[model samples]
Target chain A: MPNILVVEDSPTMRQLISFAMKRIPNSHVIEATDGVDALKKMSSEKVDLILADINMPVMDGLKLVSLVRGNPTYKEIPIIIITTEGAEEDRKRALSIGANSYLPKPIQTQELIRLVNSYLTKQ
Target chain B: MEKETGYLNKADEFLQMFKKGEEFTKELLKENEKLRYKIAQLEESMERSGDEARTKLYEDRIKLLEDEINSLMERFKQVEEENKDFASKYIEVEEENNNLANLYVASYQLHSTLDFSEVLRIVLEIVINLIGAEKFAILLMDDKTNELVPVASEGMAVSAAPRVKFGQGTIGIVAKEGASYFSDNLSYMKEFNPTTPIVCIPLKIKEHVIGVISIYSLLTQKSGFTNMDYELFNLLAGHAATAIFSSRLYTQSERKLTTIQSFLDILKEKPRR
Candidate 1:
């Protein structure tokens, strides 16, 4: 079973995402409210993949990326940034800071599955 | 002789007076004509100078204004061209993004029945096919223990894989912070795995941190990941988290219902007093 982490700020959005992940079999999906909470969760749990939002309080997605990439222990992990900011500059900054992939807001379920599958299969 | 001399003197005086009067009238007429001629000449000169000066000033002003207008027109044309280019590029980007979003939705609907594991497998396959990545992994967070656990992996050794602690490894950091992380050269950092280039993203739900997803390149020769890759991964992460969460809830509910049913059956089996 692949352990997946989902970080977002909205309850409704979180629920929607959790519902979508149910389609996958034997996958464990976890949730966090913000970057600070996510960091707290990371200290104890072993996670395989990360799905994150950019505009979050306590620690924005960009800052989280820099911090993660700076750590040698978790540097190899792939990070996917989900955000409402669709500007090219925002995407560039996310990638430059160490994000594995970027996705704009209002994502489609199939595209999400495709991206996740790519990472799962390669490992 | 005396009387005749006096009479002749008086005549001479009268004659002298008449000549003086004639001379005065002639002088007055000549002065008037001279004055008229001078005034006419002066007026003509003034008119010529005024016309010439006015024409010269008007032409100068017109030339200056024309130059200003031409420069403004050139600037306007340049601005128009720039606006057009910007509009075109914006449309192109919007179209590409729309296509990607559509593809994502279609894939999600196609695999709606698969479980989380299957979804992860599908995700990895799609990433490899679409992004040409050689290696990848998915790390999920445990809410109870607050740990990041590996759920799925490909193109890597499972036995030698290093476990990422919450807030410790790159995956942990992303999970904890609810953000994305990437590195071009893993070898440079002591904490990074021996991989050359790596990228990671946090799966988020309702602004919550759920898990982390990562991809890496074993060979140092491959080009590092780009912003587009991060965007795509983020999209997948969101959907993955949602599906997994719902599945877990459903399983929990099923288990509870089963337990309750067993207890009810025991009660029903009891004999009535």
Candidate 2:
């Protein structure tokens, strides 16, 4: 019963991600419009993993990753950065800042599930 | 006196014969004891050999059973590996099914609204999320001017929107010919060029070309088009065209109805007498 937090600004993309996450066995998905919204939701819900987009309004995903890593309370939770930014530098930056994984957009749903499952099982 | 001496000699001979007979009986008794000991030793050796044979039989049977168990274990491992492969294939099929469902939902959302802006927004979303297009524009043919005009755009500067006449360029040719054009080589360059769209899909209502959807660039992550992307383009060719066309007609009719109502209101005013 892992709780997956999906942080995306676009409604369509958010719906697509949440739809895929719901297929996991007994997994629960929480939606957030942006990184700010994601941080607010994290305080209330016990999130097991985070799937965030890098380019977002207000607080971006990279900033969120840093903040989450800095906090002792939520630092252990796995964060997967799913974004359209496919550059090697972007990936390296996200990983250096404490993101667990970086997945480019146009995501294969099976791959997404497999990566999440691997992380969740580790937990 | 002679007769008494003969009798004494006979007595001596008989006593010597009896001593010889006693020695012979003692030798026979010793031989019998040795034979009995040899028989006992042979019986013990035979018993030990029988026990060894039985132990060897049991050990061979145990070895055979162990071999059987090892062979079964190997087969079990093979079956487990095959089950894993099957599970992986099932996930792939499920992912394909989900992609189809996404296409269905996108098509459904396109026709669900009659608002012109809403239709445009839905198209924008479909391209961005489904096709992974970073910059694109939707152009509609203006009936009066006979030229394609940009109705909506995403990730493009407002000054970059262009209007093209029939058979003017690639976008114009796509509009005139009603055939989709997709670039063979997708550029990784981030520069936005309005003139050279990587993909230009003409929106058509049956054989009639209504407008065109031009894609300037795709998201960096999308390396090339997929089967799903091609299916979506076909869907937009027909379904998106119909939806946009219906919405535009509805908007125009609404405006005409308001104008007619205004005329009626003026006539009913009776010249303000």
Candidate 3:
């Protein structure tokens, strides 16, 4: 089973992503309210992939990317930035950083499922 | 007396013959009962064999159905995988469209105005909002001093020395050489800022480097330079320079027009000598 960590401040977005990931077999979705919560959760459990949103409270996705990439243990894990359309600047920044990829706002079902399955695939 | 004895012997022989016939009838009846039991057993064995054959047929049918279901499931999975591949391709196309849109916007904004201050403001907006640079400076070449001077800066030291003589500093080299510099490797800039990564590009017009836009430091939260930033830097080199140059000419032309109009008005007010 592939364990996915979803870090989003909005409960609605979290639920949407979780529901979407559930459709993919062998994918276990872990929900985190924000980056801070995500870091705390990641300490105890192993996460195969991370899907995070920018502009979150307490800690933002940029901070999370920096932190995750800085740590040797979790540096190799794939990170995706989920942002709205207007924040194209942040999207570029996300890629320039250590994020593996990104997802646009109003997340597409096919796109999201595709990204999840791709990263969770064994190497 | 002799005739009466012979009659008694004949009656005894007749009774013995009748007993032998009765025994033979009993033995024939027992043998017939045994044959009937054997026939019933044979019929039962045949019926059991028929049931076994029917059970085997039912099992074969079940195996066939299971194989069909397995094949259907396999086909379904293959179709799902194919759909996922298509989705990925669609996303790639969307990204290409996004890039084109960004380019169009960059071009439009660069050509939209001819005011020096507005041009500077627009360039600042593009760098900060579009390129995601938190710390940078825009230095226009001073015609008289032959040096680069900062006109607009963000997240940079406002009080820092704002002059770069030709062939003097990292940005100065760009101005002197009339070429662009874009590399994540910052070993050359060690004389200025060793630790922080930076991106610098010279603004040029008609093969002449007019000004330089350079990033000095990056916020820890901010990501490092991307190829997009290099592309933007390349854009600024041309479009931004043209806007600034045109805005300067427009200002000068307005000033000349004002001077000529005032002189004409004075001539009209004065009486003809």
The fnat of each candidate, in order, is 0.00, 0.42, 0.00
| Span of ten consecutive residues with least summed lDDT in model 1 chain A | A10-19
Q: For candidate 2, list the clashing residue pairs, or say none.
A: none
> lDDT per residue, candidate 3, B1-273, as tens digits?
677778877777777777787787788788888888888998999999999999999999999999999999999999999999999987776655444444556667667778777778777767764466656788889989888888887766644535788777677888888777666564444344521226777889989888888776544334455555667677888988988888878988998999999999999989865
Better-scoring candidate (TM-score), 1 or 2: 2
| Fnat of candidate 1 | 0.00
Assess every candidate by TM-score.
0.41, 0.73, 0.50
Instruction: Write down the worst ten-residue block by lDDT for model 1 chain B.
Output: B188-197
Ranking by lDDT: 2, 3, 1
Q: Estimate, for each residue in A10-95, the C-alpha lDDT of model 1 and write its tens digit.
A: 54345545555655677778898788777777778877777888878888878878887898877877788877656688889999
Better of 1 and 3 by TM-score: 3
Candidate 1 local lDDT, residue B105: 49
> In candidate 3, which residue pairs clash?
none
- What DockQ results for candidate 2? 0.50
DockQ, model 3, C-alpha based: 0.04
By DockQ rank, best first, the candidates go: 2, 3, 1
The superposed Cα distance between candidate 1 and the true structure at residue B232, in angstroms, equals 1.1
- lDDT tens digits, residues B222-268, model 1? 34444555556666667767766666566677888999999998898
